[model samples]
Target: MPASSTDAYITDFAEFVQASPSSYHAAAEVARRLEAAGFARLDERDEWPAGGRHVVVRDGAVIAWAAPEGAGPATPYRIVGAHTDSPSFKLKPRATSSSEGLLQAGVEVYGGPLLNSWLDRELELAGRIVTDDGGEHLVRTGPMLRIPQLAIHLDREVNKGLTLDKQRHLQPIWGAGGDGEILGELAASAGVPAEHVVGHDVLVADTQAPARFGLDGALFASGRMDNLSSVYAGLMALLGAPNDAEHISVLAAFDHEELGSESRSGASGPFLDDVLVRIGAGLGAGDVERRRAFAASWVVSSDAGHAVHPNYPDRHDPANRPVLGGGPLLKLNANQRYASDAAGAGFWAAVCRQAGVPSQPFVSNNSIPCGTTIGPLTATRLGIRTVDVGVPLLSMHSARELAHVDDLAALGAAMAAFLTPEV
Candidate 1:
């Protein structure tokens, strides 16, 4: 790829990360972009027809697909799966609290975020707010909150090793001895009355915009890179890919992967299954034909993997050391943690080669415990072949993470090829 293509892809990605402050925002942004690209937006409560590009949004999840004119019963699905949610603090029901003249916002750790990374950053509150009439509205406060860390002078041993009390120490201060209601603020942001807004799903997000920095601007830093990078790649690939492939190309961006994907919009749930079944039915598929389609289908679960850290070399596997700009990772595990088998690995290699992109393999050290993604869960749920792959990042889950500009573009290229797989 030319330097110009890499630069353009990274610039658009920075804009995407900025627009998507929460899962809800991410899903909405993707649908909006797809719509702009001439894809029709479909409502789940309504009927769907096959043979064109269409997208559907379910809460913080979105599924988009393009079926060719010749798509039919045995026309399998080529799905690129990703998640919309990231680890962050979630606002509680009673979101406002006052302590010792400092007004704070009540919160609970939503997922396993590096809690220490949440310290002393300008944060925003963003998500969907629901009205009494069951109407949902997206709301966001650009930079209204902060979780300040205890001063070194006060803690004295802060550098030795830092510890945080999730309940006690994680509340973000938004005001001091003032009559400010977090709910009211969210309601106003959404143009709804606080009394009329009965429910919310707000999350804390970093306010700092993504940037290209480091030597010769090769490195990009941003929040929510773990799965958003995959989501964006899948979206770009789907948008730019030819819709006349032999199979149905689908982008399934689910929510709540950080929480084990159990919710209705999660990968472990029926979101993807529901969409696939409906698409098959629209193509005049019987139960037996649908089964045959599943047997021929594939799911590429793309999330973020780790780049071996310079300081803690022992933490990473010795032989397989993936670097920042090397390429996307073909993640594997001895257990079914990642669901990447030899067959899946070979498929990924062929896809990368077809796209003219490089690739690498990622496996955890024998001594360390490995983490899992939506790969195993999706494969088990649908009984379809699935492979785990992703861009290598310095910080897997942090307030801010580092990635290579070229890797982001390379992942998109590889995904585009996987969607239309010539091999």
Candidate 2:
């Protein structure tokens, strides 16, 4: 509750977002933090180890846990779930093209991003690059590219409405020349030879750093905040909780949630289930014991939610408008788009009360469709009680987003309390 604590958490969160321009970088950053906190890294090929702090990374997905001392197969896990990937423009295989003497990098839109937000911004490329030797290197090119929007003189009706052609208008101009030069630049940035760079998974990102601002400097804004904020809170809560707590505290940051979570590392995949099973088996849990543990387990699917738009208040449900700095918002959708049901909602309310953290509720207007998160997919996959929650923000999937500094810290407190044993 100290001001210093909140400031520290927000500062760290901003640094995390700055370092993580892509899902791979995000996972790597999480792994780095976990290791720095004394969590050992585990390999899937090796036999599972006994009780201790450990982290496992599968591409852009990461699962970290701190097992309680003397914990067994039937011990329930207090899991905090989130995603790492954000909507951006992914560089295509043949990324080089020339348009009217401008060298542009061909790109494909990944997920539903506010395309207009990306126009006329300083952009950089970051992600993992694979060399012919099978070695993977993480590369961040800084602000080396720009997507210049058409001038108002060229499109006079831009104020009324604008339609973007993803294939035609989304290419970002990097420099003069062609593909060979761009490939060489990427290779040099990655410290590899151009010929050796066989493949890559990279995305363009805003180069501006996150900042705290407002009349009183109470708000924070940054990129990848839709879920990185949750990932950071979950990590802090798991690390802050005592290792001997009653439940095994697990932090799962998966990837590809923006694109329906169908990838192997996504929520719909077997990543969480597989890891849980391995943990149970290592604890000598039988099938029945694993089921029992799951029955007692719960998941807090944390992602960013929409704050009532000040300019378009009618878009939100009148009765369930959430505001920034109001504490974490509990997202509910009656159509199962979100996993929070009556029981889950009651349980989370109890947890918030115990943590002494204020809570808010959010439900989208029936006239508009609701967006889905990992909440429902995780619940369906694991059959665990799940509640969807997040910090309320204005820009949900823009190149840059805003969130409350106080709510960010409050989320960590709530998760820590949930991991702690009920007295």
Candidate 3:
């Protein structure tokens, strides 16, 4: 790709990160972009058209597909899988509380977040609120909260090793010296009545905007890039690929991977399979034909991987040291934690080779364990060949993470190659 196009891709990725603070917001932003790309919105209760670019949103999950005119059930699906949610703090019920001269918001740690990274940063409460009338509204408080770390004076050993109590120390201060409901601001942002908000699923999000920095503007930093990088890459690849490929191309962005992917919207659930079955039915496929399609289908499970931290090089496999801007990583594990086997690795290598980009291998150190993605779960559920791949990042789950602009574009190119047929 040209430098101009790479610059535009980075700009668009920054815009995507800014627009998506929570999983719900990520799904909404994806649907918005899909519609802008001429993909029609789909409803689950309604019958689907046989052939078209269609997308559907179920809670925080989205599945979009392009079925050519003569596509059938036996036509294999080339699926690009990623998640929408990231590690963050979630608001607790009756979230208001008080500390020594400040009003705070009670929250629970949602996933494996680097607790120290969240300190002293401005944050926003973002998610969906359900009204008494059963209407759902998206809400966000731009910069309403802050989780302040205890000063060095208060904790003399802070610099040596900081320890935080999740319930007591992580509550964010939203106001000084009085009780205040954070929901009021969320309601105001969404233009909804605060009293009508009967239920909510709110998350604390870092308010920092994504940026490109460093000596030559090669480094990109942002929150939620762990999975959003893959999500956005898959979206771009799916939309830009030829519509008349031999396989039905689908982009499956699920929620709750950080929470072990057990929920209905996660990859462990039937969301992707349900959509594929419906599409097969529309193509006059019975159980056997659908099984045949499943036999031939492939899913590229794209997530974020470690890029061999500079300060902690020993934490990664010494033989496979992937650096920033070193193209995308093909994640592998002997325990099936990443679901990338020899066959999947070969396939990904060929795809990246065809796309004219370098591919790096990533494996964890012997003593240290690596976090898992939705790869094995998706493969187990759908019985499809799944490959684990992603862009290399320095901080895996910090409030703000680091990535490379070149690697982001390279991942997108590889995804497009994987989804398209015959080069």
Query: Which candidate should be chosen as best, given lDDT against the real structure?
Result: 1
* Model 1 collision count: 0
Q: Ten consecutive residues with minimal summed lDDT in candidate 2?
A: 176-185
Candidate 2 regions exceeding 4 Å error are 177-180
Flag clash pairs in model 2.
none
For candidate 3, list the clashing residue pairs, or say none: none
Native-to-model Cα distance after best TM-score fit, residue 49 in candidate 2, in Å: 0.6
lDDT of 3 by residue, 260-288 (tens): 99989999888998999998999989999
Ranking of all candidate structures by their TM-score, best first: 1, 3, 2
Over 127-165, each residue of candidate 2 has an lDDT whose tens digit, in order, gives 888999999899889998888888989999998998889
- lDDT of every predicted structure (CA atoms): 0.93, 0.90, 0.91
Candidate 1: residue 123 Cα off by (Å): 0.4
Q: What's the C-alpha lDDT at position 67 in model 2?
A: 90
Task: Give a tens-digit lDDT track for model 1, residues 41-148.
Answer: 999999998668999999999999999888999998889999999999999999998998988999999878999888889999999999999999999998999998
